[model samples]
Target chain A: MAAATESFTDQAIEVAGLKVRVMQGGRGSPVVVLHHSTGGPGWIPLFERLSAQHTVVAPDMPGYGQSERPEWAREPRDLAILMNAAIDRLGLTGVTLVGLGFGGFVAAEMATMNPSRLKALVLVGAPGLQPEEGEIADQMMVDYEDYVKAGFRDEAAYTAVFGETAAQDIKTLWDFSREMTARLTWKPYMFNRRLAPLLKEVRTPTLIVWGEKDAVVPPACGRQYKRALPNARLEVVAGAGHLVELEEADRVAKLIAAHAAQA
Target chain B: MFIGYFTERPYQDPSSGYFGATGRDLTDLGMSNASYDPRLGAELYNRYLDEKVYAEEMGFDGLMLNEHHSTPFCMGGVMNVEAAILARITKKAKIVLLGNVLPIWDDPLWLAEELAEIDMISRGRLVTGWVRGTGRESVAHNAQPPFNWERFQEAHDFVVAAWTRPGPFRWEGEHYNYRYVNPWSRPYQQPHPPIWIPGVMSRNTVAWAAKHRYPYVMLATELEPTRQSYQYYDDQAKENGYESGTQNRGYLFKVHVDETEELAEAAARKYIQGPSNPFLEGNQGNVRPFIQNLPGLTSRTNLLPTVQSFALAASRGRLKEHEAATGKKAEAATASADKQDAADFLGTFTDQINKMSIITGTPKTVIPKVRHVLEYLRPGSIFFWDGDGAMTHEDSMRSLRLMGEEVIPAVREMGKSLDLSSPFEVDPRTNQPVA
Candidate 1:
């Protein structure tokens, strides 16, 4: 068993014959963090908070960050299968999966594939289910910067994380991440039509977290997730956007921790 | 030389305030369909078609058409439909499509049938061309951007195989899958019509064209860089175990000739005035970088010379807008020296004329400039881009007449002297001196 640590370290682990870049820290019961379409936020404050009590493993979801891209992987389901393989290879048991936005879709898919493998699932501003109200915001229609900024509650929150102007390296990474997202989620524009029915079978205890002011993924998606999952409750974070985890890290982490512990 | 007449078939309406001098500097893709007046569209479409028929009568070897989507800059969103019209309307002129946007089509088999029918209708006067298309096409058509190149290659292969090969073969490619690949309409041209590839700054496309020994047509790029681009094609061809010649190269440039130089200049200036095109410099000058450069559409590393020049200009345009809004110069660090050079290069209309990017004059004056280009690039095919950017039908007719009467004869003599033979005259694939 890995010892509980304050800081995270990156390790290149092989899963499904592809090099997956995993950022791991802390140790106890396992919790894997799946990232959004703009790739993993890389041990953000939310992950750091969770790392205090849980073995947090955040891999850069293949074809994103430093992870090797598999040409065969097209949709979120393909990524879910690879992530399941990754969990199996890491020897994780009674895992509590945390997915943010697009990552939530992958986590939900993982839970559906093997409900017994997961102890709890936390979906933050996730967009797997189609909202009954407004649609999931089309990322392709707007500028990349605008799309990223749309995730935050306001400019201050965005500036705090990404500074005044994103560095060229960050821009490059965002472009790469967007390309991967486009590849996987272009046709349906985020949600799978079958995901709602698939989620009905995911019996894992679930927490559907959403930002009250989310402009990217509709807040109604949280309710949709709750309705889809048999044993799930919706928690809306006030004064936050789609990236609720980044905006209100402590609150989200507390909710996730409580859910994981209870499960 | 294969002298072809081309136009974008612009949907021009001056009253809409979407085009011309003093119009809003709207981005190319941002132009709304609300501005499109179908009454004007009806008049313009037929007028353009009439001009094409006249071009054949005036001695053009080919009538060229191109496609763009969701923009008023080009009304040929479904250009193959126009090609089908030309196949029936015109005689003794190759109905050249430069060309169908391959990546946008969900099924290339439909396109194969469409083109094959056009070829059969025209009795083998179809010079088929394919373009990977720009970011606008991908977005407007809802085509996958990351898989654009892959889809383009697959679609091209599928279309060619459908045309040449016998029916009912299975095609199991990544982007496209078919249980049975069969189309009743085979192309009229033996082994399918000649495939020509046109591009702006994509080196991958240029290399691909060279590898396949397809005629690589440089579209209104600057003279020096265009020569270098053709040289790159030549080098690629040599590496691919073949010697490239004039037949393997083509150049399309804006050339408007009038009875007088002043009239020609006035008409030529309209090229930048009508329906703001992001691709055209000194026009709208508002190229949304995100829209133009969709993620993974074109590789950043393998860019040609013009891309840097264009990028610099686009960035400078953005900086100018920033300054106008904020009342302050942007950070000096962002204003790199390359951008300064591009700012100077994308200068006034006179500067463009001096650069030979836009050649306009009386036939006698324009012929010498045309001679200079022919001598420099040695292209076997030349497309005179006329009647576009809000140019009146009368303006286009005059230019076409002058080109056919004076320019074409002179250029043909120049081609003879330069030993330039078009792809039709000398087959690009077999490297036959005269077909």
Candidate 2:
């Protein structure tokens, strides 16, 4: 990620069709934060910092946090399509999409298909792009709570997930997950087997960061990403697995902050 | 030394019927509706074999074959056996068993020995493709849990050592162990056969392939991504400062050609509804640890991007469903009475999907199209999927024949006349400079 100005938190918006349990904080330019479907109160760390500088609009990304059930945004490409709808409805432009986990896939998709509206993108441990066979099958074994409990850096994030998230975030994430599952498994499990082609079209300055310990979507994914995307860079954080932002919340968030501050 | 690619599909046409026709059958069926017939599959396999023979005779650098389950799209089942068959059939062309599920099969020694036997049978004409099985495949094959790439990675290492280091050795790992790891049958090839890693657009796998300078044979990637991939591998090769892209190999766009583009397009369109659809559909994916784990037909980056773009387009309704319940335009029907048009959105989804899978045209036109893909992407070869779906024995045969006689000859002539030789001169027909 390029250099940026210092700031805190960003704005929030009520995206239509997306299940929203709650919303908060606004300031400066708008940058949407999409969290991976691994589930939790969302990537609030990135928002906690960016919200101060820009209007950090972070949604649980239907089936993620306090967000409402999405009709059916199946794969990474689907997530990008739905996000495009929300972005259009919210009338947000020059949006710098900062995504973590599967959300990184969506952000990359947005950058791929509709780069004009995007200011930049930050993807962390994104799946589907480098879709391979038998990746971290055990992690998929972990349910939302297990993921959340085992995922977060601090108890505060855990509390934020349970309290601020919709229907204690469960009802929404579950229902949204149901839709996501239908959308996902409708075929086999591929979300657009050829999403890599879009990387070249991606004009947005993309920052791909991964935790070294992030076994979910490892550092290798970041390297392939660096080669594929025209305007992209790879940053690897040590001692972080799939949950880098959570494990190294301060560091990952600060990384986002640095990218966000850049012109 | 040699790579063999076949477009054999494991499906029977309406004209024939049977299941598990060959040694490999599509087990672990996902949808109840997608059951397969083995007898018909054997018939199709024979037809595809004819094409492989034609490819070898046509003076192609190599002929390829692979595995697939349930559907004939391709998932190798006992590729070693298939390689043996190719070795028997073609005394000339390089016989490449595009792959075997290295991780899925519990024993690497068995895989190694089987490959060695095939190399002996082919008289030093086998290029091996190795990689981790997809999540679904792991579950289907009951492959020792999916996430353990390390185990498979270890197996790969063990297999290499078993081949490279000649000794009665003790091998122990989380996955497999052996008392006398060395094989009874050393491969006919001197340094064992060349290893080609078929990447599922996977970042790590691609990097590893690039880092090692293994000939990276890509299947099903689009024209643009092909360029990016070549650029990527080339950049890696250049950055790592390698003198040869030959050793850093590539392949582009699985296709089958006929006398005319119309004939080829017709054949492609036929499979578009069959293997192409299911292959793409099978690749769509789930977040389930099981599903995300597998790299299906989409292992090739070139093929994945097209699907991704189309996926984005479909989600946006940019490529609207072809028809409604009554089989009329969806939007127009919505404007009228009754909501059947709206109700049939899901069914219409299949139609929308067909738009992206098939790329049909005439031989002249397709020659340029193939060139466009080739010149732009510059893959070492093109593994034309000549037989797929219920591609009739005659049509599939026709595609192979035409591709060899008409397509290959014509493309080679065009290359010479135009001086449009590829950067990597592995393509033998043209007088291109080999890097």
Candidate 3:
């Protein structure tokens, strides 16, 4: 993996009348990093690692973090459409698209809708497919604090992201993120029922990453995703829960960098 | 002061341990259908209906009904049906649906139509209410909690439009989308039936109710907190350039009358065994601190602390008094530690009766206390909660007869003397025009 720290600058861009905050870092081929349901920790260590080898364009999805949630952005497809417009407006073609958890579902939608926009696709502990065996946890029903706890393998990992006490601003951001997830994933519950079937249409070389002890999405979900996609590789990171990117940032960055380089 | 009769119509079979050791049977989403006894349920429904009918005859101004899902706490899963039935059965008392859970209703048009039919059937005696229901209700019905508020507002707007505005219109709300919105039957009351909202001091609700100029019914809340809630509503109303008063506020109370105060205390204990506080796990009217308020349901303004203070408030008042006298908390107070002192300090039968939390006495004793509550709250309306838990049908009817004969008459006179005007009296337009 490249250096763990890289300088990043925040920029706001208009896409379909919605303001999207994108964190741009390093200098190379663009790797659009889509955040999970918890939104962004702004420029994190994972982004730092990804930025060392490749230009990391991490945009806060509409209704998450700093992005404006349009009234029309009611579903995952709406988010996908907004994202597609955002990439096109930013002129980031042949981009390696990376998404985690809820964002992975949006990424899958984007790939299915417009596969040509991406050079490769990476999904880390995504929840767009429900396995017949283990079910995805109902993130909406649980308290925000509990949901945060469920994301990491240890409490120390939580403190790393949220410090000792999550300040009011961070708490508000999480609330907004949770609300957005509810809006998008509530009806079908974290997955589009048709997403599994739709995965076949995504010709982009896909990489599915699973946290070995993921209680939230479960490893079984990764298997289902692997079986459903036409051309995909599945890699499981040990000793990590749902927040694999944060827990094993260097390992995840290596996997993504290798996958994108091979593509 | 307008007084109404209310019951949760609880299925009174506490023998089953389906409620589990914690006594939080209702909050356990898995234990819903297990605890329900249809045989007992059928009897309870008719018996509760009978009690309400007798309450109307007892000169109560309204017959209050509320809805809750997947719990033995309230059998009015569909309160509108009961309201429709009571519309034909009762002659005078207004049928107040304290409300329908707005977010859970997939079709607001159907609700509007049903409410309209009930209003027409009762000759314009419907006081419509809408509520963002409990977290348990959301879990039971799978109504998404995040959309709870939006759905409530949208459904309310749609229902109101269905009644007031010429329909066959379009509604493209964020939560609800209807291409052709129309209802065949309009409400009997001209600008639609009066809107009442019941809440447990959610400041947002108080502000919303005040802005809309609707009556805010404080649901079985503590006296001082309820006064503050009413004042909050008044403050919001003043911001919108309206002077809200007793007419714009209401309170629900658990009241049961018996031959003696001791018997009334026994009945109050039985009340704790049922929906009133049974599923709440012995917390009698104090909502379980951990589970009652869901995240995102309440405002950031001391929501959790406020809910936690129910314990502090209950403890500070009765339990503290008990502690000071008995040298132990109510829970720790033993039988040998002066039963009378314990009763006075703890939420014992005598203690509750003394505190006026559960008004239980002969008509002579109960009337004065009822008047005191009426004077204190000075509500536009009061809901006389007559039955729940194991309180027998005969006992409930007896209480009603006593209330009709004595308690209500005295309360009405007290209302007159205190210069308290009900919403119905102040806003006569809510009443149906006589044919």
Candidate 4:
């Protein structure tokens, strides 16, 4: 409805009395990307690939990036409500949903809470269930330097998160994102005990994408997601960590695009 | 003036040491469980308990106890239990639990029951205190650090309601919930026992104490900061439309006495190994900062400056030690900076006592210094810690006897001369708000 570049258009929308910043681009079917817990950096290279084929809609989750955090959205379910309202407000039906890390948890909640509108669901290195053997790395507790190091497959990919500008404001935004993520995920600690049972209600075609070496959420969690969901397939990307989408953007994007094409 | 006696009830015998085997410091969290030899611990607990019971006979108005987790520096893994034991063991002295760690408790109602029972048994002699435990406690309990303050506030509210308000009421707060919010036991004190809060000058805690009219106890913190923190509490109380006095404030310090100054200094030096060394050894990667101050635990702006000050203080102490060891005197221009750094690291126990107003002398010399600190701070109560580190039970008993005969009476006279009356002495709770 507003002026847009061929590649992308950045704007804001009000849903549930909170200002939610969203980046929209390209032309065709609508596909939304739910971001990770440590948010704020939007329109990454992977989103650029998705923009070439589909009308990609990436809304910065409330309390991260440029979005406002209303008091009601303190819990994970509150986030699911905001996502549902955002999707319904955008007038998008039968849409493909993409989630990464903290975003994956929110997307799964959205599917379970309101299963009618989603056409396809894609989860990348998502953290929502616990494993019997290995523990999900307590991402919230590590020091700053260790946190950055553990997020990527190779240390070189750290620049992708900081971006070329690498200003103090980016660090501040990242800190806020961490705080908001803690508010939502600290109690259940990155996994919901009830989430496994609720996955049975997710009837939409689903894709569970995992990194070969995800330290934050173990690859075993992806297997659990696949087994729990009624209609889902697991795909593992080689030589990447928890942020698989950022580390191997081209391949990860292609996989999601192919899934969207099938839908 | 009300006087209280305290000891950390430390397990200091290192013959069967856990930290030494792990190559970690005495305060290391990893060595917590194994730090104490149970046979020695059983003996130490009884000895300490006997010492506290004797202190009641020594004219101390209150007997103070504290809680800590995963460290031999304090064996108050559960201090309320000690309070319960003391409630029946002693008759006259107020059984002061200063206090239960609020955030670590899974259920606030259980705490209400414990406190109520203590009050009922002690026949209204319970001075209930509450605290937000150290980051180490949070780690030991695996409690969420981000919710520490929130849980503390919620649990406090719930416990107070359970004690005072008629129950069968439901609670649905952010951190706690109850379907049947009621406990059968009620406290012996009308409404509830006097709530006291002890802190090293955390601004929010001090301010909250002021708002609720809870006596704020400054524990072994530096003199100047304690002064500033007391002023902050007073200022906050004024803003809330109330007047605060000496009774509203309390101060704790290490006070050792003997026949001569040499004996007193010799005993006080033992504290260097316990509380002083831990501050110098620093965090030592034992408990991560993230585990201590989680994101969203406090207002963001306050977190960084507080953390920076703590780091700066620790480094400054190390720098001073380095200078002293190498005989490298700082230049005149940098001397002021060094002094500022030294001032920042004030929690080191020996430095706090020696530099602040920790009186270590015979009653003749000690009285004047005690008078000076009391005159300057004008607090409602003073807690004299007679035992820590390698100090034996016999040594602690002698100090208690000396305090009973000489120190307490002299300090009372000095407080009277200075016209320093405590809030309890004034009894402001019954007075209606000024119209």
> Which is the leading candidate under lDDT?
1
Candidate 1 local Cα displacement, residue B235, angstroms? 1.1
Query: Each model's TM-score?
Result: 0.95, 0.53, 0.85, 0.86
Once superposed on the true structure, which residue ranges of model 2 sit more than 4 Å away at CA?
A: A1-263, B1-5, B13-28, B32-36, B70-72, B144-148, B243-247, B259-262, B275-277, B281-359, B413-435
Which CAPRI tier for candidate 4? acceptable
What order do candidates take by TM-score, descending? 1, 4, 3, 2
The backbone clash count of each candidate, in order, is 0, 82, 1, 2
The sequence of per-residue lDDT tens digits that candidate 1 reaches over residues A1-263 is 12234498889889888999998988789899999998875668887888889999999999998999887777999999999999988888999999999999999888889877799999999887778999899887777777899999999999987888777566667767988998888878888887899888888999999899999988888888888889999998888899888889899999999999999
Weakest lDDT window of 10 consecutive positions for candidate 4 chain A: A1-10
Q: Would you list the C-alpha lDDT of every candidate in the order shown?
A: 0.85, 0.57, 0.76, 0.75
Which runs of model 1 end up more than 4 angstroms from their true locations? A1-6, B22-25, B307-309, B312-341
Tens-place lDDT digits, model 4, residues B1-435: 778898888776756443223355443454545545788878988898899899999888899999888777677788888898999999999988887889889888999999999999999999999998766677677676667788989999999999989978999888788899778899999799989998762567877888888889987665666777788888988998988888788988778887778888777666545422243222122334454445655443221122232432232222333333223343331245445434444334455465644568898888888877887788878888778766777678878889989988888888788866654576545333322
User: What is the alpha-carbon lDDT for the whole of candidate 1?
Assistant: 0.85
Give the docking tier of candidate 1.
Answer: medium
Candidate 1: TM-score, chain B only: 0.93
Best by DockQ: 1
Model 1: per-residue Cα lDDT at residue B1: 87
Q: Can you write out model 3's per-residue Cα lDDT over A1-263, one digit (the tens) per residue? A: 12345488889999878889988998789999898887886787887888778999999998888999876566788899999999999999889999988888889889998888899999999888776778888765665666777888888987876677676566556666776776677777787787788888877899999998888887888988888889899999888989988888889999999999998
Candidate 4's TM-score reads 0.86
Docking quality band of candidate 2, CAPRI definitions: incorrect
The TM-score obtained by chain A of candidate 3 when compared with the true chain A? 0.95
lDDT of 3 by residue, B1-435 (tens): 888999888766656553323455444334447656778778878887888888888889999999987666678888888898999999999999998889888888888899999899999999989998876677667776667777888899888888888978998887778898888898898888988998774567778888888889987665666776777777888898878877888999878888777777666566665455433223333333223344344433422112222332232122343333223344533335434433432455544555666777788888888888877878978998877766778778878888888888888888889977778778622323223
Per-residue error (Å), model 1, residue A148: 1.0
Sequence-dependent TM-score of model 2 = 0.53
